[model samples]
Target chain A: MLTINDLARPGLEPVNLEISAGEIVAIMGPSGAGKSLLLRAISDLDPNTGMVMLGGRAREAMPAPTWRKEVGYLPAEPGWWAETVGEHFQNWPSQQDSLATLGMPGDCGDWPISRLSTGERQRLGLVRLLEGVPQVLLLDEPTSGLDADTVESTERLIRDYIGTQRCCLWVTHDDAQAGRMATRCLRIEAGRLAEPTS
Target chain B: MSYITLDYADLAIAASLVLISGGASLVLRLDIERRLLIATLRMVVQLVLVGLVLKALFANVSPLWTGLAVVVMLAVAGREILARQSRPLAGFWAYGLGVSTMAVASTLVTVFALTTQVAPDPWYHPQYALPLFGMVLGNTMTGISLGLDTLVTSLTRERAAVEAKLTLGATIHEAMRPNARQALRTGLMPTVNAMAATGVVALPGMMTGQILSGVEPVEAVKYQILVMFLIAGGTGLGAILAVLAATWRLSDPRHRLRLDRLAASRD
Candidate 1:
């Protein structure tokens, strides 16, 4: 299970939540509603005061790299560092399954990052995140740039990955996507998170 | 053969050359005539003052005087480094890192050269020590400031990419490797180019000065070569130290990018 207790940062109210195994929790909010900040706090990306535990292991107990490895956070517009797609991945061949499921071409890895379209970068970013098989995934509008068909495939890929062991906190503005993917949906306004009224 | 001494009248002839450029600026409406004149005046006054100070120091030849000169050089270099940056670190680090790195690098290299190679009656002889320290400090200051400016700017521009790497479980050092490499290259490029172009493209100022002072051509060449090597070592060491230290300060122990430590841009 992934647990957040009283997690707080500037511009974000204190939050307490728990996501057990095989759970997909969708977070919906208007722009600048601190949805991304909440995810970043859980992933320990931004400076925040929080007690986060993954499978009962405290986030602060381990090295940051180790914590981040197990709890991956993918931004809305993922960043690419290297010249080519393959360079960013540890073993491109090993990520073939994830890449194929996301409908990425076999030669996608050879393409330069600059040449890749927005949707392509988003899909590749997803594939890159799943390569590590993090126990908790913090995805920020992971499919905001994808076409309808690609979105379905991307959603299916994530569902398949989150089968029974992992949990995900997906931030999206799409209500339909929230209905389709989330086991529980929550809303955030300003910096405060609110439980579903229903 | 003795070197010819230039009196005040001889200097006036050289000073007249500035008027040619100043007059051109006025004609072209470049509006830089005043700035050019002020800069020329400042250079004259500063160099003349230093020349007078050196005359006194050379006569006295005390370690305490040499130490004071070294301190002043380092302080000025530190201020220059801070001023040269578009976005320097906030607070003490802005001055402390560059100043300390240059102080250590230049002093170590200068002292090593003076003691092992150019041993005068006293190793701290102001004539030898001051000039060597000044040259090394000046070059190192340039290298460090350039390296730091490039480093802070690159980090700001590439924040997303660096943070992305950090999110992917890369250590801080691993995340910073590419940027650091670029900054170090920028810092060391000038010295490398100067070394490459020393004989063919340009006679270095030190060699030219020594030659004008009637040192044998071969002897001046040897001294210039030694000075070049010392400068390269000092510059490289100072740049590496400064770049690494600044990188460390820009991040946290949790491997997070602490860009908040950078001061607001002046312009």
Candidate 2:
């Protein structure tokens, strides 16, 4: 479970929200609506005034690394620091199955990062974050770069991963995808969070 | 063998080298004629003033004047570092980091040299302390400036990548590790290359000066070697410290990348 209490930032009005385990909440907003910024704040990747609790543990109570590991944030464009894909993931052996689920080869770790397409990177990004087995997932446009088929597979993997006792806050621009993935829907309009009008 | 000092006429004759370079720049349409002239003037004036001050200090041999000279040099170096940064730390932090790095690095190296190697009758002897400190400080300043500049610029350019790591359970240090390595390498590369190329490719300034002043080539080389090692240490320490401090300044306590901490540089 995740709880955001009075989260407010400049260009973003304060709002409260909660998600129980295995619940996927999709947030829809227009450009410059602070959607990505909200995700960043929830991940504690930016300056914001609020209280965020994960599994009854306050964000302030735990160290940053511990919090981040438990509450994984998969940014729109994942960062790859190493030369090869294998080097990026922490536990390659355990995560190999996750890679296979994303239509990657078992030895896909040997592939140079430069060879990975944008879609591949995004899928791999999701896989990398899931390998940590986070309790809460703050994903920003997780399927933005994927093709139609790949997007379904990615969604399936995500859904399978969030089977139970896991919360997800997904930011999506696509309405159909949002409907399919989200159990609850919210809209960000003029810097404020609200239930979708329709 | 005492080398002859250059009289005013001798100095004027030597000044023709600048005129030649300025003339060449003008002919080549480099458009740097004005810069060349201004730089020449500034160098001449500053060196002459420093020369006079150094002469008085040498004659008096006081620690106060020596300390003052070192402080002034560090202040100037700090300003240079601030001016060079593309996205400097906000407020006093920009200059404070530079000054502190230079102070710690140059002071430690100068003390090490004076107390251990140089071992002058009075440890704070102006001649030995000032010049040695100046060399160490000057080189360390460049290293720190280069390293810190690379870090800030790289962090800004690669913001997404950095945040990706941060969100992946990386500590602030782990997230910026690559940038940190690159920045430190960038800072230390010049000195490392200089050391590598010292004897074969180029005769260093200090050694050349000593040799010209009639010191034995072997003796000058020994001194040059000592200074080179000292400079390496100071530059490496300052550069690492500067990058670490700058990185810390650019982040918040909650492991966030805060670009707001940086003042928008007027390019």
Candidate 3:
């Protein structure tokens, strides 16, 4: 379970939320809303005042890297550092199955990052995030660049991965996707969270 | 062999050569004549003042005087390092890190050479110690400033990649390792190339000055080689120290990239 209490930063309102084990929470908002900032604050990537607890353990209880490992964040447009895709992954052999599920070829690991298309990068980014097996996933527009067919497969893969022990906070602009994936959906407007009227 | 002393008339001839360029710039309306004149004037005044001070220092030969000169040089070099940065560290760290690293590296190397290699009647002899320290400090200052500028700028440019690594559970050190390595390499490249090209493509200024003053070619070559090695050591050490300290400062203990610590770029 992931619990946030009074999470606040400049330009962002205090946000309190809880996601139990095996639940998916979709966050929707208009452009310029603080959806991304909320995710970053929860990941402890940005400076904000809040209390975040994962599985009865406080975010500040352990070192940041340890906390980040447990709470993996997949940015909307993920960044790649190394020359080849394989260099970024810790255990290449173990991730092969996950890569295959994302429709990536076996030799895709050896391909240069410059050569990977946007859809390919998005899928591979998801595969990389799952490599850590994070208990809480913070996904920012995870399927923004995917085509219809790839999006369905990707959503199914994410649903299968969120087993009995894991929870997810997904940010999306598509209302249909939120309806399809989220156990509960909330909307953010100008840094404040509210229930969707519709 | 004895060398002829250059008087005011000889210096006047050299000054005229600069006048030629300044005159050309004036004719073409290049607009640099004023800056050139001011720069020339400043160089003459500064060198003359340094010459007088060195004469006094040589005569007195006290460690206190030598130490004072060293302190002034290091302070100036530190300020220069901060000034050269496009985006320096905010607050005292802008000056503190570069100045301290240069002081430690240059002093250590110069003292090592003075005690072990060039032992005068007194190890603290200003004639030996001051010149050695000046040369080491000057080169080390350039190296450190270059290293620091590169490290900070590169980290800022690669902020996303670094944050991605951090979020992937990499420690700050691990995330910054590549940029630090690149900065260190940039800082050391000039010294390394100078060492490679010495005696072939160019004659070093110190060796040329010594030869003009009647030092033997072989003896001058040996001194030049020693100075070159000392400079390389000081520059390498200073650059490494600066890059490491900067990397540490740019991040927090939680491994977050604290870009807010950098001053905003004026441009």
Candidate 4:
């Protein structure tokens, strides 16, 4: 289980929550309501006064890199460092399946980042994040810029990934998408998180 | 081997060069006549003030006066660095870091040169120490500002990508490695170009000054070479320190990028 205790950051009210193994929690809020900031705080990317524990291991107990590896976050606009897409993932066995499921060609790995469209980059970024095998996924508007077909495929891919004893906290502004993906829903307004509703 | 001395009349003749340039601009309708004149006047006034201060300083060389002058120069240089930065640190750290780096690096390099290379009579000889300090400190200040500015700019521009990397299990150092390298390169470019263009393209200011002051060409070249090396050392040290210090300040103990600490640069 992932447990957050009274997490509070600037421009964000204190929040307490929990997600058991294999749970998918969708967070919805108005723009600038600290949705993204809350995800950042839970991932320990921003300064926050609270305790976050995954499976009873405190986020602060381990080294930051180690903690981040287990609790992966896919930002809205992903960062690609290397010239080629293949450079991001290193010898992961699931690469073929991930690419194929996302409707990306096998040759997509060798393609230059400059050639990839925003949608392609977004899908590829998900593939890159999943190859790391994170225990908890903190997704920030994962399907914002993608087309309808790609969005459905991406949602399917996320659902499949979280099916195997992992968890996720997805931030989205769309009410329909939230209802479709979330096992439980939480809303944020004016910096406060409301109680979860099934 | 004495060189010609320029009196007030000769100085007036040399001032004609500015009028020539300004007149050309005016005749061509380039619209820079006023700016050109103002810039020329500022340069002349500033140089004259510096010359007067140096004359008094060289007349009575004492540690107290020398130190005071160095401190004042550092303050001015620190402000210049702060002003040039688009994304300065939120508070005094913006100026403090640059000043401290320049001060530490320039002082060390200058003292080392004095003790080992120049070896003037009293060691704190204003003539040698002050000029060397000025050269080293000035270069170091520029290098540090460039380094700091580049790092901050990159951090702000690539915030998403950097955060993505951080969330992917990369340490703060790992995430910022590329930016740090680029910042170092940017900082070192000016000194590297100076080194490359020194003898062939143009005579450096120090060598030209020495030659005009009746020093042998070979002797002047030797001094110029020494100054260049000292400057390179000071600049490199200041640049590296500035980047490292910036990296440290912009992150937290938990290895998170503290973007709040940065003030958006007013470019």
Q: Give per-model TM-scores.
A: 0.96, 0.93, 0.94, 0.95
Worst 10 residues of 2 chain A by lDDT: A96-105
The candidates' DockQ values read 0.80, 0.75, 0.74, 0.81
Where is model 3 more than 4 Å wrong at Cα? A93-96, B26-31
The DockQ score of candidate 1 comes to 0.80
Query: In terms of docking quality, how is candidate 2 classified?
Result: medium
Q: Flag the better candidate by TM-score, 2 or 4.
A: 4
**Per-model C-alpha lDDT, please?**
0.92, 0.88, 0.91, 0.89
Residue pairs in collision within model 3: none
TM-score of candidate 2 chain A against the true chain A: 0.96
**Model 4 chain B, TM?**
0.96
Model 1, span B174-265: residue lDDT tens: 99899999999999999999999889998999999999999999999999999999999999999999999999998888998889898887
Instruction: Return whichever of 1 and 4 wins on lDDT.
Output: 1
Per-residue accuracy of model 3 over B130-219 as CA lDDT, tens digit each? 889999998999999999999988998988788889778888889889999999999999899999999899999999989999999999
Tens-place lDDT digits, model 1, residues A1-198: 998899999989999999999999999989998999998888787789979999999999999999999999999988889899999898898888778788888877789999999888888988888888798899999999999998999999999889999999999999999999999999989999989687
Query: Which candidate do you rate higher for DockQ, 1 or 4?
Result: 4
- Model 4 chain A is weakest, by summed lDDT over 10 consecutive residues, at A85-94
* Pairs of colliding residues, candidate 4: B86-B265, B87-B265
Candidate 4 lDDT by residue in tens digits, A69-92:
999988777888878888888674
* Cα lDDT tens digits for candidate 4, B1-267: 898877889889998998999899989999999999899889989999989998998899898998999899889999998987888898889889888988888999999999999999788888899999999998998899899989999988888778878888999998999999999999999999999998999999999999999999999999999999999999999999889999999998888988789876565
